[model samples]
Target: MMKKTDGEKNKFSLWLLAWPIFIEQFLQFLLGSVDTLMVSKISDNAVAVVGFSNQLFNALMTLFATVASGAGIVIAQKIGSRKDEEARTVAIIAFKVTTWIGVFLSILLIAIPAPIATMLQMPEELLPLAKIYISIVGGGMILTAMMSVLGTAIRNTGNTKGPMMIAVGMNIVHIILNYCFIFGAFGFPQWGLTGVAISTVTSRLLATVVLFLMFLGTFERKMGMKDFSIFDRKLFKEILTIGWPLGVNSGSWVFSQLAIFSFLAILGSSELAARTYMSTLESFCFLLGFSLALAAQIQIAHLYGAGKIKEAYKAVYRVLAIGLPLVIVNAFILVLFGGNVLSLFTKDQEILTICASLLWMNLLLQPGKMINMALGNSLNAVGDTRYTMIVSLIFMWLIATGCSYLYGVHLGWGIIAIYACMIVDEYIRGVLSFVRWRGRKYLRMKETELERESTKFTESFASPSM
Candidate 1:
């Protein structure tokens, strides 16, 4: 029998992880699109409300997702190093930490909905609906947080199918509930924006339950009460050491986005809704790139942990090589069919015109966006998170937000100019991240960290007090 070459094995691993994740994220991204399409039929104000509510909800969710991000990298490395018990323990810790954070944030959002709505500059007419939507989904964030950690951890172990199944089932439930509640179908009362929120929360809650059962069924791989009973100081510190920076990185992006939304509000809610529709369509392109990037991250993490640093580096380029062109072609098609796509949401000629023009800009934006997505995930997976965070803060805040306000608001260059400024941000960061990848700083750091973890894992098993 012939043995598989290392290259062939790597190819199998990448595809094994990538395709399921792509399908999962596609469905997840579709949730927002479905909400926007259905809400667009209700009223322009309702559409704008959904847009703002989504932004705020996503920002908070990103913050809650930090623990999962850290845990994912650690778990991936542990699995690669063949330390299954340690990986399972880290997964359980991640579940607890994120769930507590989610509960806290839920209460905070429920209590301060008005402040959040005001911060997003939600229109006065839409503010009431926005508050209701945020409160319901925000209050149910514990479910979202748990599901996120479970999905990330399992994917790190090369079980992408578990999360993908959950995402598919949950989205189906959300769509059905949305149809019934949003329009009073099947004797259900019309709930409008509030209905969307309820559907989102309820569906996510179901995902959490399904994920828990799925995670538990792997008897040899399962984590138990004992794993949660004893506190591991090093584990907690590792989680925090990696998690806090990710939280800050995600927070900076969300805040800068809110600032951009505030700037867009000046152009009127119609334009805000237009931007929302355009962004939803653009997410389709990104879903392809982002999923491939994640596949690269998972493979790279394992290779780095197994001390195959050179192979890890090569894996990154291979994924980017495929992902970049795919996204470019996808963006081109989106530009070609821009008007027809926009018409799916609303018949507003002005919004459609503006969205079509933005699709042209997407031609320039998607390449740079793909670069950033690929390298940024690679950097984070190898534990060079702080560098990416610094880069992101600088470009997203100092460059993207500054240019957005100056061109879009002060100069009155409108949405196109703001998008142009954003492109500049994307290219700048993309080039910088590419350069960082070339330098091997993260590679060296990962080598040291993996060695230390190997020692720690061995000691923990031998002495139980190490």
Candidate 2:
């Protein structure tokens, strides 16, 4: 068992946990942005292909996120309740489950990259590059899965710094490798998109290895082969119960985004490239809220596990209070300066004009997204995932996808109108999530369960020892 101390407790505070996650997330965004930036040098078509392929990759990652999210919440709660053994068991199960899923996904993507790319309505000219990038990176899903599970396990233990350090190292390696392969530096052939994909996979492989070693050192008991062999049905059920909704929720967002991407593909390469560039810049604004929401999720899970229901409830509000303003400020900065940032990638006036309009729309979009993330994550932490999942499924498809088709495609309102649809979706879902949290239903349910458990304990003690 890792020794608990004042320092350890202090590390669980929102700010301490969030800052490292924020940096880690920033580096992650940088990793993708760098890929897009470097590849944009090849051509805007290359950037479009890269962005399209990544959206598919992200959709597949929801499978891994299912396991990671489930396991992370369970581990945090178990640790909060001081059930270290259970927490460790959950971690092992998560690793085992994610490995199988990752392998299957890797094979699927690698074997059928062409078909998948075609189904996503990838442009004919882009198919060859898309296939290569997808196969190379997609073949490495196992490494990505391992990294996701390992990072989630480590962070939920309130040791966000370890993952942050790993990300910093991985990103450094990634940039160097990207330069060598993409630009034909260090005597390497200029592989272009293929080189970027290879660099991504290689960097992930290194980070996964380092993360596994760090995972071994973090826990009290050493993990052996037998640990992997062991299966706990109840714990597995708990993980799936919490994880599937999260997976579906994430799936809803990614799939809807993919649908929207296909719509942009119809709009032409200029619109697609513009959307790609804005996504990179807009990530900076939203990641602030995402990092804070993730930290609050961890903290809230711990509090809920320890039966501190009120504290858990208040923690969500605290995160909202802190996160919303920062996200708003960040969005404003992006709106003001996003064009300069876009200029770093492209000089095309049409793309720049499209991206500028999107940034203004993003200012309206981001605050709602921030609110949704803060509240939705809190609900997930307490195992109240179904509501958020349902809300996401309904609104994301209806408002996000349906309206994009209606306003952007069918009515030919264009990309700006598509963004307006998205903004409406975010606020509607955010408001529903807020109402769900405010109702205190999850807290009441948890309290009832605790009382029942208390009754059982009393009954056991009152009876003769058997």
Candidate 3:
């Protein structure tokens, strides 16, 4: 009974961290859905253009996301080990470093918008609109970067609700601004895609500023600019060491998804548009699994840092058991109302039918996906990122994209076939990740790395050699 009580307490803690993240992600999705639905009003081509542009932006951010992931892992573990100052230092360095990266990226993308559009293989008709959208949003990449880092930092400190509230407020402003600008409502000029871009950038900038203030006021660690100033070269290197593999993992998935998109592009705009719509619906399922996984990752990192490997192992199981069924339920609901959901995006009957069929396939696909997501998150937190990264690269490039090309394009099996290959990839990698976590290898690796960090931290203080 005591054991069961403790399990329930841990489960409550997991949801405490997770629910806010889920709300934030859901709002973010609604922001995008609003943009897509509004864009669809102008033209299906418009929707496709924005979809491709957003993907490009996300892929580009994958580089900076590495820093965020690295910081989160290091900070979470450091805090767990009762090293509050060290965790604060990691947060500041991450903010400073990723902010600069975001500035450079903003300038680069805005300067060469055409090349970005070309790289994405934008349809000829969609190229101009895509360029316009990218050019505007590209300039605000710094705010987006800062917001992401701040959100991660705060969440690591176990204050997920702060970021979630900020997101809710920001997305509300975004929708209102989009409505006014996109349609020329309330005497605003109808700027179309330009308006959508403006709304996105403005909202993110606002969110970033508010989140920064909240970070300063709310976190128990109480960081200062000085904490960010003493750049520990060793710690920075450690961050990169943890971060790059995670970055590669993100980049691999981005490129593979793009490859599949390219295949869909060959089928024409309607199909691509249908895919964009279907993917938005699918994101709800992704959010359910991913939010829980993130919470699990943080809890596992804390347990490992505190030398509770057995508890960490149990935590992963608990996360998986909870997350997987939620995803299955989310998929089931999507299948039930997918047709009605597709109608929100467009009136094309054929596209609607294709999207509905894909929703049915999701009932099978999402459980495997949830398993992969949950375990992958847990592995990365434990400093076992390399295994997950390598597995992702191998399966994504070789099995997922390779078969996507062969079956989706060459054999003309259409988008469903591409999705089938994707499900195959998820299950394969998911099983491997689960197996790795089931063994003692990941726990051993975590122990070694944490011990090294603790030693280095102690020596640095003992000698004061700077």
Candidate 4:
């Protein structure tokens, strides 16, 4: 019953969505990378502090991602099903839930950053800088949470360009603020790491406000207070049902990376700095694939919702075919030019040397990761979240975390060994995820659920009123 233009608008095309998302994510990456690059000029220790604090912040952001992911998938499906009113309701709930969660987390982090830092085994010398960064940046997590949910909602509506434009404006503002605050340029006080944190939080606040305004424009009718006041319990449950697994899965990945960072911390500050620098560079490659996978997820969710199972299945392969080669080529380019790129962050021969080795290892690492991302995300699109969640939890903790410790810390094999363990982990998870998608079990399960729901609706109408 949807109009042709409406259907075309909602239809999933990889390039149309992916390009904006890629640019948005890239600028977002640049936001952090700029912080790292600017802070590195101050000292490697400062860079380490920023890296550690961001990891903790990212872990917290995963909690927000839970609601965003759930809301996005549900909204995409509803849009596909022509359930516009329900989709708008889901968006309102997402914004409300993330706001409350964000406020609580922001307060918690602001109140006791030191204890969290201590629990994470933060290096003694780095604690002072870490406390300041965590308190200010972490305290503003509400902005990030709001921004994340807003962006996800906007993107699911296939309006990726809006968020991408916001990111562009945000980065321009962030860079200018960073220069002013970090260096005391233009009469701004030199606040060092605190300045960087302030700049980050301020930019995020502005971005969130703009995104919220854009969100309101997505719906045709005005969304008054009453629309938000109504609580749709069933829809909320559905969001949580799809979202919690994603949260847990992301939490596991973040924790494992944190564990790796912990192990690297034990190796010394040089190792930690190397990890931070390498991560920034590595993101350049993975974000391409990540963007593509995200686009595919949006498309696949639409197809799945419309009961176009064959198209959904084919879509994953198309993404993989495109994503794998692109990622591989990008990874190779990084390997070839990595030393020059890394040199932008640090001049220390030791850190540069460590980064160079990791770049070669990355060539092997990225392809497997691309597979995991494309297929795993495709599976998530179809609501087979539990499978990806369980697999990630098992492998990430056991292989990525455990082996990193066993090889890098306990065995004294060092950071390269830890990187090897990660490579092993990615390929294993990638294989299992591919197997799950190929089996077609999720498609069958979805069909069964749809039939059951249809039957129940029919029975409700057929039976006498109570």
Best by TM-score: 2
Alpha-carbon local distance difference test for all models: 0.82, 0.90, 0.84, 0.88
Best of the two (3, 4) by lDDT: 4
Tens digits of lDDT, candidate 4, 1-466: 3586465554467788899989988887878688678888778999998888878888888888899888999988887776888889899999999988899999999999999988888899999998898999999999989998998988997778999999889888988898898899999999888898899899988999999889887864657766767679999998998899999998889888887888888999999999999889889888878999999999888878877788889998988888899888989999989899788888899999999899999999999999999998899888899999999999999999999999889999999999999999999999999999999898998889888989999999989875
All candidates in order of TM-score, best leading: 2, 4, 1, 3
lDDT digits (tens) for residues 365-402 of candidate 1: 99999998888888887788898889988889877899
Q: Which stretches of candidate 4 lie over 4 Å from their true place?
A: 1-11, 448-466
lDDT winner between candidates 2 and 3: 2
**Considering summed lDDT, which 10 consecutive residues are worst modelled in model 4?**
1-10
Colliding pairs, model 4:
none
Instruction: Pick out the ten consecutive residues of candidate 2 with the lowest summed lDDT.
Output: 1-10
lDDT of 2 by residue, 69-173 (tens): 999999999988888888999999999999898999999988999999999888888899989989999999999899999999999988999999999899888
Candidate 4 positional error at 135, Å: 0.3
TM-score of 1: 0.92
Best-to-worst lDDT order: 2, 4, 3, 1
TM-score of 2: 0.96
User: TM-score for all predictions?
Assistant: 0.92, 0.96, 0.92, 0.95
**What's model 3's overall lDDT?**
0.84
**Candidate achieving the largest lDDT:** 2
Q: Number of clashes in model 4?
A: 0
> Whole-model lDDT for model 4 versus the true structure?
0.88
